[model samples]
Target: MILSTASSSQANAAFWRFLATRLLVSLLTLLAVSFMIYGLIELMPGDYAERELFRKYSGTGVTITQAEIDRVRADLGLDRPFLVRYGEWLWNVVTRLDFGPAFRVETSVNALIGDKFFYTFVLVVGAMLISYIVAIPVGIWVASRKSGIGDGVVTLLSYLGLALPNFAIALVLLMLNAFVFDLDVTGLVSQEFRDAPWSMAKFLDFLGHAYIPLLVLGWSTTAFQLQTMRGLMKDEMGKLYVTAAQARGFSGWPMLIKYPARHAVMPIVSTIGFDFSRSFNELPIVASILVLGELGQELLLAFLDADQNTAAGILVCITSVIIAANFLSDLLVAALDPRVRMRGGR
Candidate 1:
């Protein structure tokens, strides 16, 4: 009983330590991202409003008074020093979860999210799901058949797919859909229900158009994952333990399917998380190429116009999401590897 209680106490202590570590890491991530984002926003040539207000006629542009610009800057908290502005923004975000309004768009940050969050979410999730579905089986076959015709074919395809850019691939797919299939995916809808209300049917209709974008985003990364999975599996299959198992007549699909695949999942999971994070940030380029209704669309416009608020909002959100992805990856790694606690994972 005493030993058991001691063990329980140790477990509890470790749990708290783990939680504290995660909390500290999360706080550090937030600070780093905040500082980096603020710095980058500061570095961008000229202020958003300043550029816009001056673009038309320069000194004689809007005839805007210095007092008005100062007032506007103060109201936007732009006049404050970087540190002070950060503190103020941090306080608002922590207390209110408010990210202010977009400079380029006719909506609040929250309102923009409301208008487009579902579409982005669907696009990301669908891409991830399809990628995983395609990667795993192909990875297994390539690994099991390492250096055989199956592996050769998969390798060729993976390389070819990786060589193509996501935007180009998406553009081609879109053109084919429009020209070949006579699919009117040109404007985020079919003509049949372009005027329909926001409902499940309409949402699905939007998703139908979204599929091309998802595939474009997913295909290259999926090939990368498959190659990694194949390599990891191939390495594991050549291990002494696996060789011994095979010698013992335990050689079959079971060994490949069960043991090697299980071991291969570690790298695959980590890679998948990394890929997913990248896909979110990259959607902007794809959005521009495909004319998809997503935050990426806003991001492109933000950059073109040098709209600080809009660009910063998208950057902050994207950075936060990617940080969360990394956090989840750490948790997963810790969960998977007992050595993490004993040796301290990086």
Candidate 2:
């Protein structure tokens, strides 16, 4: 009883220590990203309101005088020192999750991002789910088959997937639908449900419309996972322990699963951190091609429009998400592989 209690206590202490280390690292990473984003925003050519007003008045025979620009800048607090503005924005984020309003639209940053964020999150998660579901079994089968015809075909398909970018996939599908199928697979939902509130019909419409985008986003990831899993499993199978297991008369699926597959899964586990960090950044072109209005689209518009607060809010949100994912991934890897936990402790 005493040994069990001590062991549990020690494990709990180690887990908390590991968590603390990850939290500190995540916080520092977020701060560094925020600083870089703020500095870049400061270095941009003009404030959001100025450029927008120029667009609004430039061809209308109304001169946007320097006086008008200055007044607008003053009113928007754009003339404040960079550090001061950054501090205020940071405080607002910390205190109230308020990243400020869109300079032209006059909507809160969160309000502008809320629905789009959900869409992007769903897109990324759906892609990842599809990638893993297809990749793992196919990868294992190909690795086990090695030089068989099925393996060859799957290998060719994976290579093709890697060669084709998501945008190319989107373009090809779009053209095929346009020229051959007479199908309209361009957007997330039909025109009727575009602005309609959520309903059973809307949800079903979304499912119907979501498959193409999901395929565009997920295909490459699935291919990459397949290649990675195949290589790792192949390597693991060739190791001395696998040879020993074979010598012990465990020759087929049992040997593969009991000996090699468990070891091969670690790299895939570790990649979750990078994958989570990257999901939001990938497939922007795909999103644009499909008119999905995902977060990547919103971020691009925010940057082009010089909506610094909106852009900053997005950066913070993305960074926070990545950090949280990293933290979780670390714990997951540690749980799956004791080596990682030991290394972390050291």
Clashing pairs in 1: none
- Model 1 lowest lDDT segment of ten: 337-346
In candidate 2, position 196 carries an lDDT of: 84
Taking all chains together, each candidate's TM-score versus the true structure is 0.82, 0.90
Tens-place lDDT digits, model 2, residues 233-338: 9888788998888888997777777778878877776676677666676657788888886778777788888778888888888788767766766777777776
lDDT of 2: 0.81
Error of 2 at 86 (Å): 2.1
Candidate of highest TM-score: 2
What stretches of model 1 exceed 4 Å from their correct place? 1-19, 43-45, 55-64, 74-84, 146-149, 187-198, 247-253, 303-308, 341-346
* lDDT digits (tens) for residues 285-333 of candidate 1: 8887777678777766776665555665666666666666666766677
- Mark the regions of model 2 whose C-alpha exceeds 4 Å error after superposition: 1-12, 246-255
TM-score of 1: 0.82
